[model samples]
Every structure is written in C-alpha cells, then in structure tokens.
Target: MRIPESFFVIYQPKYTVPCVFDLNERGTFPNHPSVTGTWGFRVLADTDLKASVQFAHLVHRPGKDPQTGKAYEWMVEETSIDLDDQLTLDSAAVEKKITDSEIRSALMDAFNEWHDNFVPMKKKKVDIEELKQKLGNVVDECKERIRKELVRKNQHWVSSNIPRRIHDFKYGLYNHVKERLYQEYQSNGGEDSEPNLLKKIALFNRVLDNFDHEDLMKPDGTVWRNEDEIWQCWIGFAGSEDEAYRICRTMDAVFKDLELDEVG
Candidate 1:
C-alpha cells in the first residue's frame, strides 16, 4: 500500500522576504536589471521516516544561453519519491547495502530530523491540558494565555501589523534557507576549495542593482526605494535539486518553530 499521506505533513509556501541587513557584500539586494535567480530542495529519507518534497522553483526562467547553447542555469529540478515497504520499515541490512553517498546523506538527515517528521508505526500523544493545570493555570487563565499567542486571522494588512508580522517571518525564513543549504552542501561531498562566499554575495548584489524589471517587485506593489524605511528582499526564480531538498527542510524548520501543532 502507498504510505499513508497522513504520515507526511503537507505545506505550500510562497515567500517574498526582504531583510534589514544584507547577506551579500555589495550591501543591498534586488539591484540588477534582469537579475534572475534560482533555488530548490530535495527529499531526504531515514528508515521509516521518509521525506518527499514538492515545491516550485522561484528562481530562473527557461531559455537557452544564446552564445553557449546551454540551458539557463535553473538551480534545481522538480522531483518526487515514493518509498517501498522495506524502506519504510527501516531495514538495517538494506540500509547497509545502499552505498550511494547522496542517499546515505539523506538517510542521515531523516534519522536526525525534527520530532514532528519522524514516524514509525505509531505516535506519542503529549498531554497539554494536564500540564496547564499543573502550571497553576485554571481554565480561564489557560484561555487567556492561549489567546495571547493567536495571530490576527482577519487582519487588514494595509491597516494592521500583518505586513510587519510577515516581515519578521521571512527574516527567520531566509536564515533558515541559507543555513540549511550550507549544511546540505557540506554533507553531500562539497569541498571547500576555491570558494569565495563574499564574492558570490557581491555578484548577487550587482544582479539585484541592475534588475530593472517588474518580476521581483511583485508579491506587493511596494517599491524598494528607501532602505531605512523598509526591509530588503531576496528573490529567486530557477532552483536546483539540492536547493529543492533544502528548501523543504528549511520550510519544515520554519513551520515547526511556530509550534502551531501545540497551539492552533
């Protein structure tokens, strides 16, 4: 039988993040004229706790490099995976036989994944109400405490703090994406040879500065003129397989941070 979809959490995220500080050296982002970019994530499996990611690459567009006849550098490819019964069972002997470095790396990631994604044949049901009671909170106090953590569902972005709330969210999300990518890169046999992190950022910033187009300016009609007044954004179009893999990982991290499972 197909592994129950319930065993895997589902999410769809379309993010437009702009940070106050720049990760690239030339300082600001979204600076280029045709400044197109790409990024994506992959599925990492651990025994029974298998991971399958489905995400859109918000990076580059499809076209050929006019001179080289090569495809535009789309960061990652679209991908999916369905695990077999033996794989889901976390068979030790089978894992030993699987010597492909990428699969092994993914398995390591899955085994050490966050508690929410790990599944065997059952689940642990933590008792929240009992803990609330033990913490000296009566029903009314508990109600009030819960209310404080709730987000404004019907909030008007133009008239409320929703934009600011989203701003903070993307801030954390960006860091989550970058850090997860770096870790995955190092894990999957990426060697630090002639790597220049600052130079990459500087080149990215140049692309942003010269990006005189309307694509990156979408998500909201807000223009990125005043740096001090509003946060700066990091936008991408075409992404790669590793990028896709890490994208899912980063997104899961963001969602888990909300502790939404326990709250809403």
Candidate 2:
C-alpha cells in the first residue's frame, strides 16, 4: 500500500527580506548588520491543517511629484510575518500524525483510482466524440478556450500594445494544433503515430501545466526537500508509544541540518 511520493502535495513555506547594513555618521559604510527573515519549511504531515499565519506592517516615505516640483509626501508600506515559532513545530508529531502508514495507504488508493479514471487506453475508451460535440468543432478548440481564459485572467504579467488578449489567443492556437494532432493519431490506427501523438499531448499538457501559481508557500514548521523525505521520516517513527520523544529527536536533527537553534 505504499504510495508514489508525488501523489501527496507537500507544503513548503519561504520568507524573503532585504539585507541590512550599519553606517558610520561620517557617510562611510561601517559594518554589515545581521540579515534575517528568510527561511523555508515543508509540511510533511497534516495536509488538511493550515499551518502558517501572515502578518503585515505599514510605513510612510517622503517623495516629490514630477508634475509639481513642490515637495510631495508619499506612503510606503512594509510588511513582515513571524515564522520562527511555527517553523520549530515538532517534526516527529507531524510525521506520526500526518504521514503515517495508514494515510500513505489511503493516498495510494485514491491516486490509483484517479489515474485509472483519467488515462486513455483501449478497453477504457475516453469519449472523444462526446467531448468534441460538447466543445464546439474541435477538441483542441475547447482546450484553447480554457488556456486563453487562464492567460487573460492573469493579464497583470502582460505588457505592450499588442493586447494581452492576443497573446493568450496565440498561445491557445498553438496548443490547439498540438491537441488536434494527438486526437487524430488516437482516432486513426494509433500504432504508427502513437509516439509522436504522445509527444504532442505532452507538449499541450505542459502548456496547461503553466497555469499554476508559482509563489505558493508551504505550511509552517516542516522542512524537507520533498514529500518522499517527509514520508521516510514518518515511516521511521510510526507505531511508537513514545511518539513525542521520537518527534523531538527528529526535530533536533532537522534544526541541526538547517543550522537553526534547537526549539524546546
């Protein structure tokens, strides 16, 4: 009942801040002040739990407006959150509670069901004709519409007079071509063109994959590169009555590895 590590969504949280410096009153820079506030952690356990909290701070800055040479005031806002507390949560408790063998088994079962339901095969035929009919003329057309909509919705990233809508349309067109090729190969005798078809499918799939947000933060109090590492740690400590003590040891190791002070 072991699950492929990728089946689970591992959470990781990261903090970012500017470096600070102390300067001599004589206009000469003197020493480097400690730079703090950046760290990352992965949530190995409790997929359902919300682990991090965000806090914000505000500031005022002075500036001048170009139109009116007179001095004008401006406001600059600064924000920060304290992650150190949650980042030190006991890892053993997380592993024991979240990534236990039973949870892994359940995840595998769910993943298998999802994979079987989605992947194309001979015996389990996907209703291409129905999909086409429901989605106007071409199956590619439907995918294109979805892709364009996604890009349009994220128009903040686009610039230039070309119109953000045009960019999305072009992206959608390219994807449509790739999907059409895939559908054609699948409908015709798949053996000769199957590999090429799969390549095209992968290409279009990659485009669709780009719609996810890149800045998502993981839950607080966990630190592992990936889900597999988290699961391995969990499996090592499962089924023990002294779960808290075991968790403390695991946390100690994690902190040492990250060069962080041990949390009590």
lDDT of 1 by residue, 1-264 (tens): 022222322221222332111123222223221223232222333223344443222224455655556654332233344434322323353245444456546544543362234323223553434432322223233323322322121112222433444455446544544544445445554343212222222222332442455443422343433331111122121012243333335345544654564486
Per-model TM-score versus the true fold: 0.22, 0.18
lDDT of each: 0.33, 0.32
The per-candidate count of clashes, in order, stands at 38, 4
Please report, as a residue range, the 10-residue window in candidate 1 with the lowest summed lDDT. Answer: 229-238
Off by over 4 Å in 2: 1-59, 64-72, 85-264
* lDDT for residue 161 in candidate 2, whole number 0-100: 23
Worst 10 residues of 2 by lDDT: 20-29
Q: State each model's C-alpha RMSD to the native.
A: 23.0, 25.0
What TM-score does candidate 1 reach? 0.22
Writing each residue's lDDT as its tens digit, candidate 2 over 1-264 gives 121232221222232443211111121112222335211122221222222211111112345545555443322222212222222333344344343455435433443354344333454564544432332333333333433554443223222222434445347543434444434444433333434333323323322222343432222322333433333332222212133233334333433544442242
Candidate 1 residue-wise lDDT at 261: 41
How well does model 1 score by local distance difference test?
0.33
